[model samples]
Target: MRERWRQGRAARRAHHRRRGLRARLTRMFALVAILAVVLTTVLTVGATFRVLAQFGPGVGADTAWDAATWQQVASGAGRSIIRSAVQAAFLSALLAIFVAGLVTRQLTRPLARLADGAERLRAGDRSVQLPIPPRQDELRDLTATFNDLTLSLARQEAWRRGLVADIAHDLRTPLAVLRSEIEAMQDGVQPLDGAALARLHGEVLLLARLVTDLRTLSLAESGALSLEPRLLDAEEALRGLAEAYSVRAVEAGVTLTVHASSPLPLHVDSDRLRQALGNILDNALRYAAPGPVKLSAWADGEGTHLSIRDDGPGFRPDDLARAFERFYRADASRTRDPQGRASSGLGLAIARALVEAQGGRLAARNHPEGGAEFTLTFPVPSGEPPSPQTRMVTRAPSSSR
Candidate 1:
């Protein structure tokens, strides 16, 4: 155990040390080479001056430093100054090679990390994080940019896994429901009354919801999350969500409330805004234990705002941090809901993506008063179309949700 601990400490210390030494060595070695060149220049100038002085200030073939004695001066300078310069140049070049090698080693650290990260990704590791240096040097920026890419890749990998699991789990519930209903009919245990038919219909509706959400996810991932911004009534948007989910809320025994401080006006993608609002509302209704589902919107100093809060079982610290991760179910069990109903869990992820794609921000938190609140903040139109439209989205057929 002690040997293992020592090895760990050594590795950590070496890693931290290597993190900066490349840049440091590069600057130091370049400075030393320049200084050496400067020194050689000064010495060569001095040798020229010494020869001029010996020639008695008159540069002529017959002077003391002239033809016959010029050989001595020339030989002396070449034997000493030129040779010394040659040696010095060779030494500095050698030093430069050493420094360059060390610096290159440091620089390649990121490349090595990139390779390792790629290999781990290839090996299906979604938890890899690349080490990047602090400043914004070109190589450091490249490393940071690569790490950012890796981070995004890791997130998408996680999303892909969640999507598969959600699909399997989602299919199980409906298939089981349909299977049970079919078996009952075959066994004549329960007559295929409208009530029994209604259960299958509900299952089909749930399946439809799952399919719709999955298709949306696929479209979003394929870079087709397009939007058309327009000036719309914020209250109307909130009302749309309320109206869509009103029946579901009623069936779930959850009250839906729409509170807006009089038509909060804003510029936004109407359909995307509606979808975001619906997702939040749906999530609140689905997860909240018998309680009120509150939808509220208003204008703050920054922009228009909308939130859906529920007096449900709120998230814990871990869950809240990753609540927007696609299909990340805090309640992973199948038997936790009030009516044993479960979710596909992509609601919040899609909601936040849509919100952000509109030059807005969305966040989820546990209300101090005992529920979870998701807030979407949008920037008010600044009297001009944003440059090239919102950047986080790609173009697709426009729709009003």
Candidate 2:
């Protein structure tokens, strides 16, 4: 009971100490108005007495009045002026207070709403949004900024929740498989043979890959990914990538080709760029089996452009919109590669993260020739020019499937 009493007393003190901005502003305006009225009245009364001394009771007249009469006349006129000035000042002061109240109310209403909305936000309500004032003033700008902040917080919260769910769902499948396999072997329902061991090993590898991809993605998105950037010939890099993946293309019965109009210079991290390119190529090959895949590079006034086009089915509208989302696959049923290896569904996401980390952009769309195309653009640094070699290079495998 004593503790409760202490709490109640503290609450009372806090309430008393809470001086509102509206009240303070109103008081300030009232004080200023009253001061102005008093100052004006004093000046007006002084001016009236001076004028009376100059022209009243016989000054500049044929018959001049005595000093005593002049003094009496001046006193009477001064008193009358003071009385009228006081009355006018009193009425003006009242009007000033009323206007001050109205103005202060108008100003403080938005501030009060903002404070309430901020309190709600502090209590973990991300959706708290204040109504924006219609007046084109600082208050409106402030409210708009607050609304933007609220929207950003909401989006981040949603993304965090979705990430957790996706991680759990991805982990559950491989874990379940591993547990079931081990349990079956222990129960003597399945033989401890090479195939069984291989299956278990595959699940373990899938789990490891998923974890690694997640870490890389997290680091990239958080701007912590280390990059060793250098200037390199774009044509040479494309040729090297094509050569590296030629064997895979041949096995998949796909024709891989690289084309460059000239030696385009690019400044980027070589290893990271290769990884991003490899991931996109792998994705294209996965879907465009037995079809032609083209790699083209060029530099223009805008930037350096690298495009990969695959003669396969393009993305649906929904898939295109969410292509960079983690663990988002257009065809949910196909979760494994043709070789029966599990896919973590983070390839496109990782590619985008890596590209963006290097200050570049990646985009996907349907090519005019009815195929999926992915383009990567890297901005040229200021005061830098394209490579002067100007040699056009086109590399293709000697044998095409």
Candidate 3:
């Protein structure tokens, strides 16, 4: 155990020896400059010694100079050169240290600020704004990334708070109604009968549906949703969705129709696809004007496209942008249906999430002809070639519509 502890301590010491960016960079510049100065000084001294040796004693015997005099001259020249070189090296080292200190501080200040901002963010302060410097460098890129992270976190925090509030609001209405009805019945004010019981049952069902929708959304958001994908008839899927919602549409004084253009085959999660399409149809039936809601499916070179168009007051221009945001309703009028039943605003958001999870895209637009239309597009899966017979097939309008 002692040996193990000692090894751990040694490892930590080694980790600390690996210095941060500024210290490492400063040491690098200082070492390079010191090396240059030392090399220059050494070369200068060596050249001086060589020159002195060449002219001294034996080679100068023919000249007037004696061996002792030559030795003295050589010795004096060598000392002077050595001293001069030492002084120059010392001065160079001082300059290197000063320059390195300046450069290190310049590079490290931005990173220090970034570290502090990160800590603040972790502490739940989303208002920390990092001012990006004008310099085109890694620090600028880092600052920009940090800024985007801050903005994203702020938006997510806001959305979280809004979701909590919306959920509470939704749950409160049904619960409050149930409590009041039960209390009234207990006090002999409202008698227990078929009528009163049905009202209570309706509230219970509404609560159940809201909880179910929330669960679906949660699973889809967390990437925990299980999907079973297979190749299936796209036309059949559309017709199935239309038939499921046809009764509700008729009761709401709206006509629902499905127009299949061809033998459209698509690889998708059949049940999930149905849920998404059903949500779209339900939304149309609830909010659209009393007119026909058309569902159509067609195949093209790109892939398969399914559209649901409703003859209603189309989405407001501003609302169109955020139509898929969870718990978002365009206005108060959208809260309840004509029969005073509440609508869970998570339908479109969940539908989009489910569709995208299956490698498809869902989009909404104001149809030029009259109302709002939602289009779902899925690309042909890889390794699955389009069938040669899958040509564009448009059927004439059915006489029933």
RMSD of each: 11.1, 11.4, 9.7
Ranking by TM-score: 2, 3, 1
Worst 10 residues of 1 by lDDT: 388-397
TM-score on alpha carbons, each prediction: 0.65, 0.81, 0.81
Better of 2 and 3 by lDDT: 2
Model-by-model lDDT, in order? 0.73, 0.83, 0.80
Global Cα lDDT for candidate 3: 0.80
Error of 1 at 348 (Å): 3.4
**lDDT-superior candidate, 1 or 3:** 3
lDDT of 3 at 208: 92
State model 2's lDDT: 0.83
Per-candidate clashes, comma-separated: 0, 0, 0
| Candidate with better TM-score, 1 vs 3 | 3
Candidate 2: deviation at residue 97, Å?
3.8
lDDT of 1 by residue, 1-401 (tens): 66999999787557645654555665677787797788778766776666557645566566444477777767875666676577667777777787778777867887788888789878977677777766445567567777787678877777677767767977888899899899999999989899999888878877887788877766665658777888887777777676666666666777777777655667888887888887777677667846776777777566777788889879999999989886677777632345655466778888877777777899889999989999998876666332221111111112222
